[model samples]
Target: MALRACGLIIFRRHLIPKMDNTAVEFLLLQASDGIHHWTPPKGHVEPGESDLDTALRETQEEAGIEAGQLTIIEGFRRELNYVAWEKPKTVIYWLAEVKDYDVEVRLSPEHQAYRWLGLDEACQLAQFKDLKAVLQEGHQFLCSTAP
Candidate 1:
């Protein structure tokens, strides 16, 4: 069976006179072990929990962000399938906006560090083709809907 995970692609719009894709920043957390890869808040899906529930719960546990503190963007979701440790893995991500850019991020022991970066910087840090694509698509979605 494939391992399933869910997460939120959390982003915040920086308040500035000129608002564009560059004004958006995404939240990424560095793993505490292995390659120490950076990824958005996510975790394995617990038995009996819905995918969105897992995403919200993981976001809170991994990034100190609660469901109430984020605005879930409708119509934006991505699923990635890959191989990890000789097994198949599937991850689902939903686009969400941080209600306040100033909210604090408290990392759990599972992660050693966290950063909020623009699309280019985030793609550089993500260092994975699928994740980079997800970030790019999220940025384009936000840009297309911006006023």
Candidate 2:
């Protein structure tokens, strides 16, 4: 059986006079262990928990962003399958935008640091191709959905 996990591609829009894709930024947390790679907050699913619930819980536990502070984007979900620790793992991600542009991010011990970065910088820091692709896809989704 594949190990399943879920997370949110959390982003915030700058309060700019002119709104554009450039004014959007993604939140990525740097893991304290492993290779210290950066990625969105996520964790393994616990028994009886829905995927979205796990994502919300992990986001709060890892990044300290409460569910009330985010607006989960509809119709935008990405799933990636890979091998980790000799086992098949599947990760599901949904896009979420911070309601308050100035909301703070408090990281837990599992992550050493966090950054809100633009699409290009975020993809660079994400490292893995699949994760970078997810970030890019989320960016494009947000851009296309922007009014």
- In model 2, the runs with Cα more than 4 Å from the true position are 15-22
Please list the C-alpha lDDT of all candidates, in the order they appear. Answer: 0.95, 0.93
Model 1 lDDT tens row, 1-147: 999999999999976665533489999999999999999999999999999999999999999999999999999999999998999999999999999889999999999999999999999999789999999999999999887
Clashing pairs in 2: none
Worst 10 residues of 1 by lDDT: 14-23
Candidate with top TM-score is 1
TM-score for model 1? 0.95
lDDT of 1 at 120: 97
Would you estimate the TM-scores of all the predictions? 0.95, 0.95
Q: Candidate 2, TM-score vs. the true structure?
A: 0.95
Lowest-lDDT window of 10 residues in candidate 2?
Answer: 14-23
